[model samples]
Target chain A: MKIIYTSFIGFVFLIVCSSIIISDLKGPESLILGSWDEVSWEYERVNSTENSNLPLDNLVKKEICSNMFIHEAETWVFKKNNRLQLVKRGHEEEELIYNLRGRGNILEMIHKDNGTEIYQIQDLTKNKLVLHFNFDLQVKGIVKMTFSKVD
Target chain B: MLRKFNNYRTHQDNLKIAILTACSAGMVNVLSVILFFAFTSNVTGHYAILAQEVAKGNWYQAAIVFIWISLFLIGNFTSNMLIIHSKPGKSTYLAHATPLILEIICLLTVSIYLQRFYLNTLWETEFLVALMLFAMGLQNGLTASITNFSIKTTHLTGLTTDLGLLFSMFTKKKYRKDKKLRRKAQILLSVVTAYMFGGISAGILHIKVGYAAFYIVCVLLGIILFYDYSVLKIKRRKRSLFTRKNILFSKKTL
Candidate 1:
């Protein structure tokens, strides 16, 4: 009886595991893959005394849209080839290729330059995208972007 | 009459254990896959694809997942039933080998089907999905064998409910015999924890590396196979030695 019971469990376990793998391989690709125009991104100073103080000079240097645009960027590419490369003018020639993967709609991208850099994309749509980043300095941030298709 | 009732009770116990182990095993593999590779247990999760499929009168994909799940259940049932009838040693060997056998069969079936339907546009690119289902079936089949029927790793519905009941028991009068219950709780907790870990790990790994999850499952299956084969070989050797001695004695007497 005990042996019977154990075999039964093994069968169930395999089924669930396989289903999960199926989802990752076959489910709807997350909507974050489309192009996006920079709207807003927040960069927190790791050593700042006043956590809320936004460096005015840093904010003004970029093309800030109504106190928006966290980082200076005209366009960003969320590719299907496991690369999320940002096309920014000043940063490294290409934002260190962040390895991207997903199961269904949930997408996670890890910056290969530093494995500690994690980005999550959620609540994605044709017109809107939410980018959540967990940086290496233990600082967390969000970027809310709204897009208009450029024909 | 009492003996009959006791027999029924034992049967009930065995059934309960079987169900528990199967569920826990499923949960464990789901969680492990998610933990190790960002894979998801449910294809749609909260998505209404089933409803959409139903509305569109295209229930084939949804039915496929269901059928996959059913095969897994059937595999579990067969393994359990076999163990119930086999001699103790033979049962042990069957318990471990059945899942391996099922996986091979499933893979062959999927490959054959894909070959036949390769030209069909409406067939849908679901070969991967089929493989996933087969893998899940194998995983649960094996897990059911390893941890006994005390754990259910696939769906947490029963395990979570049982945990709630146990917690309520904590508030009631303490029984010295509750020690067994406590041990049961610990095992359930560990399996549940492993399951959650699997989910997180699969999620992260799938995010980082895609399709590698299948290789991981293959590795796990291989380990179990090696262990079972070794045991079977040892048992066969022991039996052969005993038979040889018996034959030698008969020849000496003749």
Candidate 2:
């Protein structure tokens, strides 16, 4: 009886494992691969913008060149040979290279210049992409992000 | 020397039992994540992308999958309680039987609804989630119950951490390793590995076959039921045969 039970379990295990293998091999579109571009971004405050009491319309037109890099650029790139190289001319010198693997349309990338930091592509679409990056503010580390896409 | 050797053998047997428990528990957690990933990423995640529908405030549709999550929680709660309370040997059949019946009814209901009335869009998603929750609950509950508290198949957050502890203890080599602890580690690992593999497989299936994953669950439950019944029938036959032989022997003696 014990032997029977053991064999029965083994049989079930084999069946389940085989099913997974077959499904994994069954398709191509299941692989998320392609070029994606940034459309818009949502940013976290670097410091109290208390210095500026600008109105909403003026704020939209305001592009302050403060030393603090509060905004991040959203960029998309195509991938081949397991590596994704972004085509943005200025950002090319930047460590922001994307790699495609695992599941879905997810991409993993690293900022080369700032080797200390990492970013996760939280969400993406044909027109829009969302990126999350972490930084230290005060004593604690915090996450902030930008959403962007090509018009 | 011989007496001492026998003691060593029992200790070894106990070790195997512990290992199996730890493995099974780990498998449960991995599989749960895998199932969730597969369902959301491949099978049904697309529904959420219907922004137009969402903008219309289709609460019914939005709430459908969540309700399934709720049902699954209910199933787990029930099964966990039942397993914890019931005598180990007596509860195995019940563990497998209850979910099997519930799943079948759910499936039939879905098919009928599709064939007969136009189900509200919200109702359709809710129904699917409910079916999934109930089925998963049964699967996890029965597996957990049969194995006792030693193996949990539905979730793994606890198992992986426990395995880490056991690994450290093994490394320290300070105190005499407890045989009971060793048995637990084995069970936890087996369950954990199996469930993780199951989830990966289910994820792949979700991509290729859609909700047919539920059908597979149904089949596995059926297999479990058949196995339990067959074992019971054999036990009954053996008992009846023993009784007949005893009666004949008494007649001859008389």
lDDT of every predicted structure (CA atoms): 0.47, 0.45
| RMSD to truth, every model | 11.1, 16.1
- lDDT winner: 1
Cα-based TM-score, every candidate: 0.50, 0.46
Error of 1 at B34 (Å): 7.4
TM-score of chain A of each: 0.44, 0.39
User: How does chain B score by TM in each prediction?
Assistant: 0.57, 0.61
Clashes of each: 61, 43
Judged by TM-score, which candidate is best? 1
lDDT of 1 by residue, B47-120 (tens): 35445534644333344444444555565655555445556644455554665656545544534554454332
lDDT of 2 by residue, A68-90 (tens): 33333334444444344454544
Considering summed lDDT, which 10 consecutive residues are worst modelled in model 2 chain B? Answer: B1-10
Instruction: DockQ for candidate 1, please give it.
Output: 0.07
